[model samples]
Target: MDEHYEKETFLLRIQAINKTFLENHQRAINIIAAMVAIIGFHVYAGFAIAHDFHKALPLFVLMLMTYAGLLYFLLVKQWLKKLEPILQLTADVFSRIWNFTLFDISICKVISVIIILAAFLVWIIIDSANSRIRLRSVGGMAMFLFFAFICSANPSKIKWRPVICAVLLQFIVGVIVLRWPAGNEAFRWFSEQVVTFLNYAMIGTAQTYGFASSPPEICGFSAVFIFSSLQIIIYFGAVVGVLYYLGIIEAILSRIAWLMQYTVGTTAAESLNAAACIFLGQTEAAILIEPALKTMTESEIHAVMAAGFACIAGSLFSAYIAFGACPTYLLSATVMSASVSLAMSKLLYPEIQESRQKDIGSFKFATSKFSVIVSIH
Candidate 1:
C-alpha cells in the first residue's frame, strides 16, 4: 500500500509540474500579446495624430514613446526569466512523449504545410490580378532555383519548407515595397524622418569639426566631406545599443521570429538573428545570438553569414542615403534581405539536424570587436 501511495504521489507531482509549466508559458505569451496591443496603439496614435493635426509628430514625443516601449519590453524580458525553468520542464515533458508513436503530425510540420498553401494562394491571387504574366519573371524564378541547387552542399538534405517560405516572403515583401502605394508611402515617411534626423546631426558634426572643415560650396562634396558622414554611424550604434539593452529589440525580434519559426520551422536563434539582422549590423546580430553560436550547425552559421553579406545595417542606411541611393529602396532591400538571406543559406547548407529553441535575452554589446585584430611588430 505504501508503494502504491508513493506511485500516486509521483504521478500527482508530475501533473502539478506540467500544469505549472503550461501556466507560466501562457503568462509569457499573454505578456507578449499585451506588448503587441501597445504597439498597435502607438502606431495608430501616430498615424491619427499626424493626419488629424496636419503636423509631423515632435521628435521628442517619438523618443519618449520609444523609451516607454523599451522599458515595458525590458520588464517583460525580466519576467520571462522567471518562466525559463518552467519552459525547460515543459520541453522535457514533450521530449519524453516523442517515443509514444501514437501520432505522426507535428505542429511545426502542420504549420509549415499551411503556410506553403497560403503562400501559393497569395501568389496565384496576385498573378491573376496582374495585367500580364511576364516570361522574364518565370525565367528569374528558374535561375533562383538553379542557383540554390548549385550552391547547396548537400542537395538531398535540403529542407523544402524553409526554402519555399523564404522565397514567398521575399516575393510578398518585394511586391509590397516595389508595387503597393500604401507600403511605398509608409516607407517613404520613415525614410524622410531618418534623413531629417541624420541631416540634423550634421549641425553637431559641423560644430565639432569646424564649419570650415570642407565647405561644400567650395569643395563640391569632397570625398573627405562625404566620409565624415560615417560619424553618424557611431551615434546610431549607441542608440541601438540602448534599445537592445532595454530589450525592445529582443521583444520585437522574438515575436517576428515566432511567426517565422511557425511558418518555416526555423529555430529560435535563426529567426531572432534573421530579424535582428534587419535593424542591426551582421556583427551585432551575431553577437545577439552568441550564446547559441557554438552549438549551432553549419546551416545556422551559414544563415548568419548570408544575412550579413546580403543586408546593410540601420547605421549604414544614412551613409547609403548620402551616397545617393533611394532611401525607400535601400530600406526595402534590407527588410527583404532578412528572409532572402535565410533562404539563400538554407539552399546552400540545408539543416540536417533538428534545431532547438535557445534563450534570447540581452547580450554584451562590444563594438570594439568589430575592428580588425592586428599585431604590429
Candidate 2:
C-alpha cells in the first residue's frame, strides 16, 4: 500500500509539472509571436515611409516603447511573478536527476536582463541615428534566426535567452574590436609578439631541418617553413598542459564559464567547453570537460559540437598567418566565433530538457605520466 501510494503521488506530481510547463510554454509562444508582429510592422512602416523613417524615428520609438510597457505591465510582469515559484519547483526536480544545478529566476536576474536589453536598444537607436543600420544586415539576421528556428529540435520549446545574449555580445565585441583604436593597437601588439615568437622557433627549426631555401643557392624572402612554423602548436600544447596541471586553466575557464552561464544560460561544463573551444581544438576542449561528457544531455552535447564547428583554435592561427591571412583579423575572428558558435548552437538545438552535467570546480588532466606524455606529444 505504501509503494502504491508513492507511485500514485509521483505520477500526480509529474502530471502537474507537465501541465504547468505547457501553460508557460504557450504564454512564451504568444509573447514571441507578439514581438515578431511588432518588429514586422516596424519594418513595414520603415519601408512604406521611405525618407520619413528618419523624421518619424522618435515617434516610432515612443510608440514601440509604449507597446512594450503595456506588454510588460499587462501580461509579462504578472506571468513572471507567478513563474518564479514554478521555475523553482522545476529546478528542485531537475537537480535531483541532473548533475548540475539550475538557476531560479530572481529579481536581480530580471533587472540584469532588462539592463542588457536597454543597452542594446540604446545602441540600435544611436546607430540608426548615425545611419549605420543597414536593411540588408537586418534581413540576413532575420534569415539566420529563421533557419535556426526551423532546425531546432523542439521549436516550441526553443529558448531565446542564450541565443539573444550570445548574438548581442558578438555584435558588441565586434564593434569594440573594429571601431576602437585601443583594441586595434592591442591586436597589433599581440600579432607582433606572435611573429617574434615564431621567429625564435625558427632557430630550432633551422638546426633540425636547415634554413628554408629555393633551388640552388637562392634564398627565399620568407623564412617560414610550413612544418617548422606549424610545430609551434606542439610547444603551445605543452605549455597548456602545464597550465592545466597548475589549475590556471581551470581557474580561467571557471571565471569565463561563470559569465557564460548567466549570459548563455548553460551549465558550467557546456560554458567551459565553449570558452575553451576559443583557444583549443574541438577534441581538446572536450577533454577539458571529459568527466561530464558521458553524462551530459543531448542538448549539451549539441552545444559542445556546435561550438567546435563554429570556432577555430589558436593553434592554427600561425598556419593561417603563413597562408597570407592577416594575424589580427584571424585573432579577432577566433574570438568573435566563440559567441557565434554559442548563438548558432542554441539556435540549431535549443535546450528543452534540463542538462544532466554537473558543475565541476576544477579539472586536472596532466597529473599522470601518460597524460603528460599525451599532452606533450
Candidate 3:
C-alpha cells in the first residue's frame, strides 16, 4: 500500500514538471516569433526605402536609436539601479526650485499679465506676417470676451488664470494646425488616416445588408446614410469597448485629466469628464463619473454639461466626414472646446463652495462587466 502511494506521488511530480516545461517552451516560441516578425518587417521597409536612401537615411537611424533605447531600458535593470541615486538627487533639486516662491501673489499676477500681453503681441506680429488679419478674427475675439462678461454669475468671483490659459492653449493649437506647415501636414495626414479607418464601417454595412445594388435616393440623399450611421456606431462601439477593456482609454484620459486638473484648478470629476467628452458622448462621459455626480457642486455640474454641449462625439466622426467637413478641423475644434468649455462654465457659474472630490486618484472609472466581446453587443 505504501509503495502504491509513493508511485502515485512520483507520477504527479513528473506531470507538474512536464506542464511547467511546456509552458516555458511556448513562451520562448512566442518571443522568437515576435522578434522574427519585427525583423522581417524592417527588412521589407528597408527594401522599399532603398531607392530613397538619401531621404530616408535619417529616419532609419532615428528608428534604430529609438529601438535601442527601448531595449536598453527594458532589458538592463542593473544600469537603471546604478542611476537611481542620481535620478533621486535631480528630482529633489527640481522639487525645491518648484516649491520656492520668490514674489508675492499680487506681484506675480502683474508679472504674469505683462508676460501674457507680450506673448500675445509677438503672436499677432507673427500671424500677420503669415496671413492678413480679417474681420472674422476680431469678431471671434470680441464674441469670446462678450460671452464671458454676459454670463458671469458673480463677476468678482471669476478666476482669470484658467480662462487666460484656455484661450492661450486654443491660440497655440490653432497656430500649430494652421500657421506651421509641418504641423499642419501632420494633422492633415492624421485626419486622413482617421477618415480612412472610419470608412471601414461601410464594409460591415454592405455585408449585413447583402446589397446587390446601391439603395435608391431618399429626399435627394442616399439611403446609405441610414445604414452607414448605424454600422459606424456598431463598429466604433466595439472598437471603443475593446480599448476600454485593454485600459487604453482610461490611460489616455487619466493623463489629460491630470493636466486639466493641474492647469485649470478644477475638481478631479470635472476634469475627467471634460477629457472624456473629447472622445465620448455626454451621457457616456457623465457615466464615467457617476458616483461623484450626486455629490457634485453646481459649478462642477455646469462644467460637465458645458463640456458635453461644446464637444463632438467620436462616433459621429464618419458622419461629419461624409458631409465634407475637414476632419483635422473637426478634431482640433473638439480638443480646443474642451478647455474652453471648462473656462466658460467657470466664468458663468463660479465655484464658491469647496469640492469634495478634488483629487483624480479618488475617482474610479466605470468598467464593463463580463468579456469584452460580450460587453460590445
Candidate 4:
C-alpha cells in the first residue's frame, strides 16, 4: 500500500511538470526575446553606422522586415478567429456553488487551469502530431463565458471611499494649481523646498545607516530633498488642523447638508455628517456631528457608509506615492471618491419624504494638542 501511494504521488508530480511544459509560454517568451534582440541590434547599428555605409546598409533590410512582419500578422493574415476563452461558466458554477465563497471559485480556477493544461496537451498532441492526432470541437467555451460574464456583472463588495477620495483630491489639487498658476508656482517652490529638506534628512538617515561616506551628500540642497518628503504630509496636516480650528469644516458640512436635503435626496443630518466624514477619517469623521445617529434612518446610515467608502486619508498618501503612484492621480481619486460617495448615497436613498434638521454639534480640539505634542516630542 505504501509503495503504491508513493508511485501515484510521483506520477502526479511528473504530470504537473508535463502540463507546465506544454502550456503556451511562447507568447511571452517571443515578445521578450524579440525586444532584447531588436534593442541590442539597434544600439550596435547606432555606433557602427558612423564610419561605413556598408554596415548601415542593413538598416533598409531591418525596416523592411519590421514593416513586413507587422503588415502580415496584423492586417493580411486570417488563420484563427476560432480562438475561444479557455475559462468558461460550467466549471465556474461548479466551483463557486453560487457565490457563497469566492475563494472557492478561485481555487477551482487554479485547479482547472492545471487540469486543462494537462488535458489539452494530450488532446492537442493526439489531434495534431505525427503519431496519431484527432481534432474535435467541444461545447465548453460558451458555458465558461456565461459564468465569466456573471462574475463580471456582479463583483464582490468594495470599500469605495479610498477610491473616491483619491480621485477628488486630484481634481481639487489640479484646479487649485491651474486656477492660480503664479500662486501655485510659489506653493510648488515651497513644496519643493520642503522636499529638499526631506532629501537632506534622507541623506542624514543614509549617513546613519552607513550609506554615505561624505558630508556634502548630507548638506545644503540634499536637506531640501529630505524636507520635500516630510513636508507633503506635514503641510496637509497643518491645513486640516487650521481648518478644523477655524470651524471651516462645520460650514462645509452645513452647505453639504443643505444640498443633500434639497437636491441630492439625503436627510439633512446624514449629509452633514457624510460631508464632514469626507474631510475626516472614517471613525473620526463620524464624531463631528454625533447626536443624529440614534434616530438616523437605514438609508441615512448607508449614506454615511457610502461617504466612508469614498474618501481616503492624508496619512496614507506618503506611502502610496512612495510606491511610484502619480501624485495628481492619487489626489484626484480621493476628491472624486468623496463626490461619488455623496452621489451614490443619494442614489441609495432618494429624498422624497420630509427632511429632518440636526444641530451642528461641536467636536473637541484634540488636533491642536496632537500637533503640539508632535512639534515638541
Best by TM-score: 3
**Higher-ranked by lDDT: 3 or 4:** 3
How would you encode candidate 1's per-residue C-alpha lDDT over 1-377 as one tens digit per residue? 99999999999999999999888799888899999998987787777776765344554457587788778679977888899999899989876664334366566556656887787767756776765455467568769878888978999998777887887788778878877999888788777887776666567677777654346566465635443666677667766666665656666777787777766667778878888888887988898888778778878888888888888888787888877899998888888888877887888898887654443333232233323333223
lDDT of 3 by residue, 1-377 (tens): 99999999999999999989889799888899999998997887688578787556545755787687578778776687889999899999976665556554465555767898798877686657756565468568769877886878888888777777777777777878988999888788767767777778887677877552146665765655566676787777778878777887787798899998887778899999989998887877888788888989998999999999999888888788878899999988888889888888888888888899999887787776656445422
Error of 3 at 264 (Å): 3.0
Pick by lDDT: 1 or 2, better one: 1
Q: Arrange candidates by lDDT, highest first: which order? A: 3, 1, 2, 4
In angstroms, the error of model 1 at 286 is 1.2
- Candidate 1 deviant stretches above 4 angstroms: 1-55, 58-133, 212-214, 219-227, 354-377
Per-candidate TM equals 0.65, 0.62, 0.74, 0.35
By lDDT, the best candidate is 3
**What's the lDDT for candidate 4?**
0.53
Q: Is candidate 2 or candidate 4 better by lDDT?
A: 2
lDDT per residue for candidate 2 within 80-113, as digits (tens), equals 8889999899989876654433476455546767
Q: Report clashes for each candidate as comma-separated counts.
A: 0, 0, 0, 55
- What lDDT is obtained when candidate 2 is compared to the true structure? 0.73
lDDT-superior candidate, 1 or 3:
3
Q: In what order do the candidates fall by TM-score, top score first?
A: 3, 1, 2, 4
- In model 3, where do residues sit more than 4 Å from their true spots? 1-104, 129-136, 212-221, 372-377
